[model samples]
Target: MPFIAPWTGENVPSPAAMATRLGRAGYGIGYADEYGIADRVRGALWVRVPVKPGAGGPLLGRIHALRQRQAMTHMLCQGCGQPTVGGRADQRHLFLTASATGRPVAEGEKTVSPPSCAGCALEAVQEGLPSGRRYVAVLVEHAVVWGVAGIVYSPHTLAPVLRDVGNEFTLVAYDDPRLPWTLACREVVALHGCTAVDLRDLSERTPA
Candidate 1:
């Protein structure tokens, strides 16, 4: 796929445009940090550019460049510090999938890409099991209290952990009518409670 600059508002750029930009700017294209969805649910791409010997690029540009090249940026597992690869590459193992029904449950279609390495993916899968537990618990608690169903986690609270731990969870929601305040509360609690469990044993064992 050809690269399109988000800043330019180009939805999709042709190969010629991409090559033109690359030649002019000497930028190498791969995948950007902002391209993919968490846990590989959606595909993403990163671009790398070599700055001129002494020509300093904008801070954002430099940061983006560095991020594109980071090992973790491309399926390097944060837990075991290993490159997730082969059949062991299960991105869903690292991301949590939200329940479709109002009742909280575990399991979902694996829409995301797995890690690039086995060891890293194993640790991620272990951790995701606990995360799924917490996620379901929070959802059930919210439903019992407020009688609403949907993704109940704030991105602000969830993003940090999601980014740190890995994208093993995908929040989903129902279209049933419910109070906005109740829905908000569910999301807040879900985000906060998911990470409030015993960190030491979360990945050591499955939730009872």
Candidate 2:
């Protein structure tokens, strides 16, 4: 199972007493007892989600914030929860993603998906790569912590601002001025020095 995959038992708690606070730039969302040192990341307030992996069956399209952060920060495989790199000689990490354009992944591309180990990569191919999605695999020389996928809130009303048409979530960068008011859901990373690889070729060379 993917390390960052959310289970059915893990769900976002209701915002019973959720509140906003004064930030340096503007008002930001938070709980009354929420600590900036613990909850805020890159000046953005992250949404609080329960951390209960394996409490139920895996939630296919959802991600667990804490596990996703850990996997991205430590270069752990999203497929099997193992380290992507083998040793000092193996510095490059393998990242697999669904490409909407059907083009190979490029350098300086940003993503929230974590890296995959060789074993998991093969398994993913055998399993058909998540239904109808088109996948692109790459060997990333460097994956940099970029920002986050979050909900931007209204400073005046202290309510979540509806996302723009056709957009799922607001992507806020660490340096953005509006980051303080955004409630982060997932950590995002930029893939650098990417070399796209064919899954079939990779599966052929990799042993079972």
Candidate 3:
């Protein structure tokens, strides 16, 4: 099934489970020094799962779970978890969407979502997903590995510090020195050559 988040979908919570003293990759709920990411530094924006923990666990979405898996393993499609890239420039993966129809997708667009095969991209458009209508296709011409979105912990205590007033964690880039100490969940990729295509139009041109 398509990744349907609870916020936009039914009353379903996240389909993941992780419990520790400190949050890991911003997905679970924990306390001070519990989440051990890596060697951390002070003053850096890290991306993480924002959890206000209710009864069971923090309310996480399916997309969040899928993203974590994608980060660890490269060459996987953000759309279907299938192998998209074939280790060549022309064989690079795609980040399909419908946000920019008839327009060119600019570079430097950060995407936590995974890559997609051409067939899956087309199917998503035809089948339709949560925000599928406006999300046009996005081809990742150049996907340079960026840092992750995680939480920034206290240098001494190792507890996640709230940078923003109410925000749980922040976006941490891989270039930051404190990257090792942050719990990364989503795998972020810089999108290039985002080509917006209209499926209906393409279908007409095809011989099939």
Candidate 4:
């Protein structure tokens, strides 16, 4: 059988499952040995079960919906202590790079201008500006540790930062509580360790 996520078009299947399906179908050599279409077909069938309409779709759809919800929940800004519903259209938030001494440097400052609302502007000020040295350091460290872009949160709104930073800096949200703290540790380790953070191990250790 082949695995398929009907709603999202994602594929899923185990090697053993693929082999068994191919063998039962009278296919030779088994999918595991060849790693060809036979294997893909089997995997797709495994996930996209031949069930009634709307059966398998819900599973993938639900996950996507949850992610959307998380994104919306974190869009609010933390600065100005209010939602960014009526923020200026021309204003933007700026994020400055920090130096070795932990002080914010203006050499490669990144700006996120025309924030949709005041909340977003405040979040940029507190999380990206030079005044927020400690917060920026924590966010950068977390990104390095996770082998991903850094995460920023809105203090007043408890929302995550969602925007672009720069080529070297990627902006991400703190949707998961533990993710922020974990990234902070990884950043410190990255300074000394050659290996990147193992996402699988981190997932297993943390709870959703």
lDDT of each: 0.25, 0.78, 0.49, 0.26
lDDT of 2 by residue, 12-58 (tens): 78853557778766666776888766787767787777888889888
lDDT of 1 at 82: 51
Q: For this target, which candidate reaches the highest lDDT against the unseen true structure?
A: 2
lDDT tens digits by residue: candidate 4, 71-151: 223322222223333232422222222333554323222222111132232333344434433322111111121122333
Off by over 4 Å in 3: 2-61, 64-67, 86-89, 97-104, 129-133, 163-169, 199-208
Q: Each model's TM-score, in the order given?
A: 0.20, 0.88, 0.55, 0.19
lDDT of 1 by residue, 21-52 (tens): 12121322222232223212111112223323
lDDT of model 1, residue 75: 39
Off by over 4 Å in 2: 24-26, 204-208
What lDDT, from 0 to 1, does candidate 1 have? Answer: 0.25
lDDT of 1 at 147: 22
Candidate 4 lDDT for residue 164: 62
- Candidate 3's residue-wise lDDT over 140-191, tens digit each? 5677767666666565665666677754445567666556455554556677
What is the overall TM-score of model 2 with all chains considered together?
Answer: 0.88
Model 2 pairs whose backbones collide: none
TM-score of 4: 0.19
